[model samples]
Target: MEPVAGSLLAPLLLAGAAFSNHLTDSYGATANYWAIGLHISCWIAQFVGHGIFEGRAPALLDNLVQAFFLAPFFVWMEILFLFGYRPGLQSRIAKAVEKEVDKFHQSKLHGNGRATNGKIIRTIASLALSLAVYKYAHGDPDKQPLLTRWLHYYDSMQEDFKRKTYMNIKFVEEAGKDRHLFETAPFVGHMELKFPE
Candidate 1:
């Protein structure tokens, strides 16, 4: 009905990014809790805004999607950050989150093969949730304007994250460098280099 939810989402995401950065700076490899908190907060903010402020109810099904699937999108991002992607002011914050996740898995939280499986599961879950939200909630022509705008923002973010991730992995594969996989990663000019634990 209004741009309230969309507008609020931008700040929510920014806040999450800021918070993550702070946590990363302070705790380094032990920032999983911060990532989880950010996801949970985002979900609550969106849910409340859509249902209360927008007066849209947002459907129980939509609520479920937010709770069960969409909430973890951020968490998955954190896991990806652990892999060595550097943070960019011009890029999506998801890249940073993913690097954090990789750090968690590589360190004390070592999950062995199961942790890798968790990443796969989370990926599937996020895709399924995004599809569900897109197909069901974003279909109404009346909502197309808002939905399209939101998707545009989301896509830009997702793309930035994906691009950085691809480049980081490619660097590792080609140079056989493991620096991009560290938790206390160093910032080098415009690129990020992760250190080995």
Candidate 2:
């Protein structure tokens, strides 16, 4: 248990730090869109890594969470496309909504202009979304067990990546802030696995 737990400590800490940074950095305005987008990308990446690269099934909890995160984007996209065709819906509104979508389009026509912006926006949106999910999921210590269990699943699946006994634990010193520090931990150190993957 010590070695297995140690293997997860560093990555979990790193994920917590990264998640904190993401939440704090996008706390206001249109930044939430960017944060959610980034999280969506991460979900997709993890899904691909687990299903394709790792040749394993992704944890059911993770898949459920990913679906939850994607629900907003899918609904929003549908709304945008729907309003795009409605008569007398302000042309400006349509254009603005369309602009949001332009970012998702391939660069075959414009040579990577919109795609780059879209990538940036989506990344931020994804992060913001993840922060919200984390907050909700972690809102109660009782609920945290479910998340921790999912993390355990994710970590267990990553056994192939485990290499050493030494671990670096990352933790958020502040909520919704970018302050974080990593602490070296022995295999037997006290550390909670948050986001092992």
Candidate 3:
């Protein structure tokens, strides 16, 4: 609707602007007055249509900026859409909008619109994804449950970390020469460095 309206009106408006300098001041004022009148009439018509036909209010009432500015930008994009511009992106956007609208209506009908179970849903998705990856890498999960296999994977990760940090652990001499340094450490907390005197 917007693209069609713009395509029809834009050329005439541009032509009027181009020729306006040739017109007398009174004529230009008349044209401006006529344009304003048409705008107001169209706005009223829109309100009537929304009230009678659509059974809902215009989004202009909700957001003037979105209705006036963003709407024309979208209309321009729609005009370009006729030239096969980002068709896949447009369809994906349409699908996502449809999905969101459906979710909104469902939520409104059921109860509040508050986002519920989002964390639980994410945890379930992550667990399911990990389980699938685990099965792909290590065969059937039925043989050795997801958590059990996950624990084995976790143990290997800890082993890797321990290997990387091995330099931090003080090693005793073969005959336990520096064993005294190790024993002088507190039962808990930091140990005083026992340098050989």
Candidate 4:
């Protein structure tokens, strides 16, 4: 296929290169303008021809390599088949194309790849959920998996609050009012603010 495609395209490609080279030799830098115009026009013609003759968008829209490189081989093979090149191979190809088309149609009906993607996502999510449930049900209560740890976060927070409460001494506003208590306090000779009772 590569050799066939290369052989079919090389002449045209070389001719185009030669033409551009000739333009550059004759017209200097101005040749670039003409070459650009021709290049654009050729691509335009390619897409227009695909629309008119094939009645569908060009393969370039979906796959550039298929349109540019492989298309010539495919077209050549089809032409060969028309002239009885390989009947058996052609029949097999036809069957395969038919099967693929049917598969495509079925997938389209099932919402065109979304169903498959959704099924995968659902499977992953269900497995994660099931694993979480199993861990919460049977695993040692001391250590929890990262995924299932959030369920106990509030309880852990409450325990932390209890610990924090035990660690802190109560603050009494009147303790500062007694001069002896204030004198014996660690903050000696520090300026203190006293509010009226």
lDDT (Cα atoms) of all candidates against the true structure: 0.57, 0.53, 0.62, 0.64
Supply the TM-score for candidate 2: 0.22
Q: After superposition, how far is residue 197 of candidate 2 from its true place, in Å?
A: 86
Tens-place lDDT digits, model 3, residues 90-137: 787679878977876677578642433443354346446745774674
Q: In candidate 3, which residue ranges exceed 4 Å CA deviation?
A: 1-26, 100-197
After TM-score superposition, what is the CA distance of residue 163 in candidate 3 from its true location, in Å? 89
Per-residue error for 114 in candidate 3, Å, reads: 18
Q: Write the per-residue lDDT of candidate 2 for residues 1-197, one digit (tens) a residue.
A: 12533453558658978886576455632344465568668886865575456333344333666556554444544554475533454465568868855653434345755644554455556557866876775576565434455555766767634533223122222421442223333356687879777
Give per-residue CA lDDT, model 4, range 12-55, as digits (tens). 77998999668766775456555545765776687567546643
Q: What's the lDDT for residue 178 in model 4?
A: 75
User: Which predicted model would earn the best lDDT?
Assistant: 4
Best candidate, TM-score-wise? 3
Candidate 1, residues 61-110, lDDT tens digits: the string is 33667656565554544544566434452155556757865775465345
lDDT of 1 at 10: 64
Q: Candidate 2: which stretches are off by over 4 Å?
A: 1-106, 143-197
Which is the better candidate, 2 or 3, if ranked by lDDT? 3
TM-score of each candidate? 0.22, 0.22, 0.41, 0.34
C-alpha lDDT of residue 142 in model 1: 66
